[model samples]
Target: MLHFLPAPLRGLIGATLLALNTLACCVPLFSVTLLKICLPFPAAQRLCRWLMDFIHEAWISCNKVWMNLLGNTQWQVEGLQGLDYQHSYLVTSNHQSWVDILVLQYLLNRRVRPLKFFLKQELIWVPVIGLCWWALGFPFMKRYSKAYLAKHPEKKGKDLQTTRRTCAKFSQTSVGIFNFLEGTRHTPAKHAAQQSPFKHLLKPKAGGIAFVLDAMGEQLHSIVNVTIHYPQGNPGFWDILSGNVDEVVVRFKELPIPAEFIGRNYDQDEAYRLQFQQWVNQLWLEKDAELSELKQRFPGH
Candidate 1:
């Protein structure tokens, strides 16, 4: 049992197994991607997608096996009733540590569609994994800052145009899109520096989710709001692998995407932007309170 092993040995073993699992899955994924690229037919694309999904689900299954074998963490989860894997979803959560991604993958793996993240366009060049992500249909977003857009003038609406095209691709299949509304992981220093309005979260940015809703239109079924808490403290990935983190709490709440938000231009419409921001802020407020209660109930977790 990993409990009897030294912390260093536990971490080393867990890391090694995870690396091996990733490599095993990625090799076949790369091959399928090449095949999809070369064939460029609708049927071939669908076949490649099905194969990639199988490989990815197997990878997640392997990760779960390693977690149960190597980690001593207790999972407390709630609000997952009546989820349909075939439906499309827009999932948002509070970002605490890098380990949150693993937690989401573990909990939501077949309850909904496979989780796909919005990656920066530049990440597509990050070597082997980059092509794997592209092959798996992760949308690469090219965002132009306001200052840069001001200088270019002609490229102002380019980002949203790209988002619309990406959404069109996603409409062909059921998929779950993940957006970390805070845009970055949380830290005490960041919390203080931003003068954050919430007790436990950084300010939620409205633009990303707004664009997603507008781009996806009615194709997206519902919003899955997730709150992840580590009552012992936010643990790094190594802490989880080393059997140091004892408990993780995850809660899921599903809400309908308000009809008014669909097809509304977040960049051009002032009223819609304010209303969407207010809605997101309210969600953050509730999450902050829920986190406080979770920590209180599981003292010394």
Candidate 2:
């Protein structure tokens, strides 16, 4: 096994495996695109679904290979079975490192239609990856600043309209909408600057989740509240591959879709919006407590 190799040698092997993983994923991706464009309706859909399955399988295989070869980072996922592919879901997770994305892809893939993320409208032009994301049905949002909204008051609800239109197009399939409610990666400095009420997370941005709920709440079955912990430390991507990380613990808790949350106007109804914000605030509080306990157990770098 590569685990017994010298540390430097192990890192080389890890890098090699990562390269192979990327190369391996491309073949199926290209094949799916070709089939999607050339094939008929149900046939194309079937082929695309198969490609998604292949990608998810490759992801697992690559993660397993990298972890075993490097032997420093380990992953533990709880409540993975809580995800239901048959129903729509809004998955919220606390952001920490780029590793969070990989961890998400590892856990949520196949079970959840490839985990569509909300992106800024500009990300639609990031070359091949951007095109792939669009093809896979990720939502691109145009966020307006408060200052701009005040100047052009009529434009206030336009973003929500855009979101609703985009999400409405997928009539038949259930999708997993993933958002990091903290809005950015968590850091001690960001936490302090934001003066967050929660001890562990930065301030939660309710607008994103509220918009999704407003646009697609009827189809949404549950909210997947996920908490991720880095026991060794929050490491960068290279740190993970170089056998520097200790372990990652991820927890998922599925909460039912509240009746009041459905069909609410998140932009216009202050009372409904406040009620939703409070609901998210309570989840962050529980996550804060969990993070505290986890920090005590894991400590940090």
lDDT of 1 by residue, 245-284 (tens): 7899899999989888899999999999999999999999
Per-residue C-alpha lDDT of model 2 across residues 1-301, encoded as one tens digit per residue: 4556676777777777876776667667767877777876975686676676567556556776676567755667788885767777889899999878877876776677657788888998986567656666678887889899899999888878877887785545677788889888999999899888888789899988888888888888899999999887687877656666677888888999898888788888999989988998988999999989878876665
lDDT of each: 0.88, 0.78
C-alpha lDDT (0 to 100) for residue 250 of candidate 2:
89
Predicted model with the maximum TM-score: 1
TM-score between model 1 and native: 0.95
Pick the lDDT winner. 1
Assess the local accuracy of residue 149 in candidate 1 as a C-alpha lDDT between 0 and 100: 83
Give lDDT: candidate 2, residue 40.
64
**Model 2 — which ten-residue stretch has the worst lDDT?**
52-61
Per-structure clash totals for the candidates = 0, 0
- For residue 114, what is the lDDT in candidate 2? 56
Off by over 4 Å in 2: 4-16, 34-43, 46-50, 53-57, 125-127, 152-155
